[model samples]
Target: MSTARKHDPISVQDYLAGEAHSDQRHEYIAGVVYAQAGGTNRHNAIATNATVALANQLRGTGCRAFNSDTKVRIRNAAGTRFYYPDAMVVCRANPPSDSFQDEPVLIVEVISETTRRIDEGEKREAYLEIPSLAGYVLVEQSSLSAVVYQRGRQSGGDQGFQRSIVSGLDDVIQIDEIPLELTLRELYEDVELAEPDSTDRS
Candidate 1:
């Protein structure tokens, strides 16, 4: 996503209003709006696969899975922000009149080269602050791997999250909060992963 250049800060009300009529989607950070760029075929496929899987499993469970078009509203001491996660599951449905969801049980972000930083850092931090959020997942488009952060007690006996790394197509992500388990093969179905760069070393 690219930051809107030379744009003045706008209020949350104004941003929401503008977004309703705008052709493209933008993420609101405090008073600034960042224009979201289109994703690659692989990115779209992964997101769709995850959403479909979740939706299928959540049937008759009183929970709903939302696609990227739906926004997740974040309100904290810093300010109000709205973000479009790749896919999200909300057990407590928001009112039909509401355009954004305030309580998502699970939030998924399909990470790409351009969005890796923000998705893993800023967005992860913000999403974890939500009391209703039980898990935050970051899926990689370049590989069959995912990083999951599940709400749990820390080693220090304080409420926090536990990070788990899931790799390989045989692996699966199990979230007891949503009572769902998704395997890597299912999430990457028909999606062609990008070739790794030989020169890059992490």
Candidate 2:
């Protein structure tokens, strides 16, 4: 996402300062800040459902669930960057007092038409760079599909990740990061998903 700049490149400090009081939220990349788009009712509901499910299961487990308001920092070739995931679970018993979290086990995003590319591509790569992150989930708003990318260890001693595409309501995720099992039904509960287009294939 290319953020328009009015003058000289702004510092990260300035971006954080502006984000503190700004009515709207923005993502800081390198030295530029890009305004985040507003989410629809469906988007918000999906995020809320995921958060609630996570929170209920994580109660007294020492893990905490954070909503979109919390930012996550990542260091990459592009330098330090910050993003706001729709839902995140940090396993740290005692995290820092900063407004953002640096080590999250799971990072979730409810995909929208406007941000599909960035979420699935750029953000996906960035999230994987985090050693503490175990998985990155992308929930589709227009359908009952969710994709999960999780770190896995092969028998050959190679370390990488595996990707799973879950669609049916019966499909459930058994992640190693948390003690809870997340099902598609729990995520889409009490919410209406956007109908697929007539020409949609698979």
Candidate 3:
């Protein structure tokens, strides 16, 4: 993401108004707006696979899965920010007119070379502040792997989070929060991955 403007801080109301009529999507961080870059073929495939899998499993359960077009709003001491996650699951429905969701049970982000820093650092930090978020997932575009952060039951806040890694196509990620399981094979389906580098060991 790159800064869209360099002017003084803009109000959330003004940002929303501009977004409604804008041709491109931008993520709002506090008062600054950052233009979102288009995803690669693999990025789009992975995001679509996850969204479709979640949406299918969530049917008739009152929970809905959303694609990158939907924004997740986070407000905390770090200030108000709006991010477009690759995929998200919201158990509680938002109003029909709302453009963003404040309460999401699960959030997924497909990370690439350009987005790895913000997706794993700033975005992760801001998302952990949401009391309603039960799980945050970072999917790697370069390989068949994922890093999941689940909120521990023993405590609250960021300290109560537990991180786990799931790698390989045969592994499955069990999201107990939403009671759903996703396999790496399904997530990487139709996506072309790079060949692993072979090391010379004598």
Candidate 4:
């Protein structure tokens, strides 16, 4: 899914150069570049709350939490793709000091109505290609629910991602990539959510 801006297929180098100076963020898929859409206040709040919580927990630890500014380079069946996740965690001893992280252990994306399918379908499939990635989280903005795809410990290789949907304010998401836990309360702290509708149960 693309927003208002899109460009003819460009080289990775050109994309990188342009993105460095561009005020807006863009994702490079193969050669085509797509502009990132702006988030709502609720979306921004969720991302910020998650980042702050993760960052504070990761302090003094080798693992680090990164906000949307950091790009994640992914290699998937489709091709080379670069995405800016809502928040991510990297645990490499000496991760590349480049504009992106190629080895993120966990990737989190806050989904809106427009990007819901992309986050849960296309993005989830692509993110699992990262060998170091053990978890991919999708947070819903319209409701208090989350979907998680976590790699199974006993699974042979990169082929064992298990999906689970978590709901309600009291639920907690146990991250397999890092030794950290995220509660729905912590993720949505300070943000006022709408009341759930009786017909909205899914």
Candidate 5:
């Protein structure tokens, strides 16, 4: 029998370089890459609600927002990374590539059950790597709760911490970059989340 030696895993550099040619988009984590799952109807609706709401609020402002289809590059000490955010707003600087916005002032990821762990853990860590990143929003599909992680320092690195969780629908997250406020309910207006069953006791 013949035995073959396995090769090393792909690095963040390799993933970013071949992202365009790759079959699908993947999230970078700890120098490893993982593919994102296609979201559900509820997920889509939730993301749409947030994006449109932000668009409406940021219309006259200089910042422009995008949906999950937009690619993003976040840099950390490990390497420069990339991920597709659910709702992203950029107003910092325009780049020559004109393909994907690099520095977004605000980024929101509607967390799905399948991707929730990564979004809350890996992706959450990845977005903080960006220097221009002032805020990171995580929208929960199971409920109306949304987590907002903000950076206190004008610059990036290990200077910021998790600001707070904007759980209540009435609560609003302040976007210091473009300078706007988004309500939790607004981000889940069209979203029809599942209701908790009363009889399902373990």
Candidate 6:
């Protein structure tokens, strides 16, 4: 089977220190790194649409939301992550340049069939490890569904402990840390379905 940047295994720190101006998105797993294919215009639009919505909702608040351009570092030696998210919101304030975010209140990843399973499965599992993470949201570009996970403690029968998965966007998802009033419709405002040739039409 093919791997996503399997040739070279790098630490989270090493991947961050390097420049990403070369293009091609990348994902980091454990310690290995790999590149991602460019998304179609619709894919790009979905991400942009969500970013704007979140940004607008978060304005004036101390919280800050970022597009894929921002690097999310976690559990590394210093700052930066092996993989960058499609969209993210941080309630802890921005970090200094050259350093990645150590505290993130919310993380959002746009689901792609190619990576959807992993994003909702393996990637999700990895995100749950972040101590400062309050929520993780997934926006499905296909059905325009948003799956949200929130931080809190829940009673699990005799074994009560920490829990997540606050609510979903089958109706409309709201992220508590990121202004707590955003709706899924805003994230899909201008998004359209992909064509047969995979071209995004206006």
Candidate achieving the largest TM-score: 1
What candidate 3 gets wrong by more than 4 Å, as runs, is 4-7, 154-159, 194-202
Checking candidate 3 for backbone clashes, the offending pairs are none
Indicate the residue-level lDDT of 151 in model 1: 86
4 versus 6: better TM-score goes to: 4
Candidate 4 lDDT tens digits, 1-202? 4744477888888998999999988998888898886776777888999899889989998899999989988876677889999999998833455889888888899876667767877788889878888899898876888998888776565557899999999999888658888889889998866333211111
In order of lDDT, best first, we have 1, 3, 4, 2, 5, 6
Better candidate by TM-score, 4 or 5: 4
Error of 4 at 4 (Å): 5.5
lDDT, candidate 1, 98-171, per-residue tens: 78999999999998766777888899999999989989999987889999998874467536788999999989
Please, what are the lDDT tens digits per residue for candidate 2 over residues 87-198? 9999873356577888898898988665677888889999988888888899887888899988875577527668999897889866775655788898999778776532
Span of 10 residues, lowest total lDDT, candidate 3: 193-202
All candidates: TM-score? 0.92, 0.89, 0.91, 0.89, 0.77, 0.77
**Clashes found in each candidate (C-alpha, N, C closer than 3 A):** 0, 0, 0, 0, 0, 3
Q: Please say which candidate is ahead in TM-score: 2 or 3.
A: 3
lDDT of each candidate versus the true structure: 0.87, 0.80, 0.84, 0.82, 0.72, 0.64
Q: Looking at model 1, which ten-residue stretch has the lowest summed lDDT?
A: 193-202
- RMSD of candidates 1 onward, in order: 3.4, 3.6, 5.0, 3.8, 6.3, 5.0
Expressed as tens digits, the lDDT of each residue in 38-99 for candidate 6 is 66777778788877877887888877778877766666443334556777788885545643
CA lDDT for candidate 5: 0.72
Better of 2 and 5 by TM-score: 2
- Please identify model 2 stretches exceeding 4 Å from their true place: 1-8, 93-96, 153-158, 197-202
With a 3 Å backbone cut-off (N, CA, C), the pairs that clash in candidate 2 are none
Candidate 1, residue 10: how far the Cα is off, in Å: 0.9
TM-score of model 6 vs. true structure: 0.77
Better of 4 and 5 by lDDT: 4
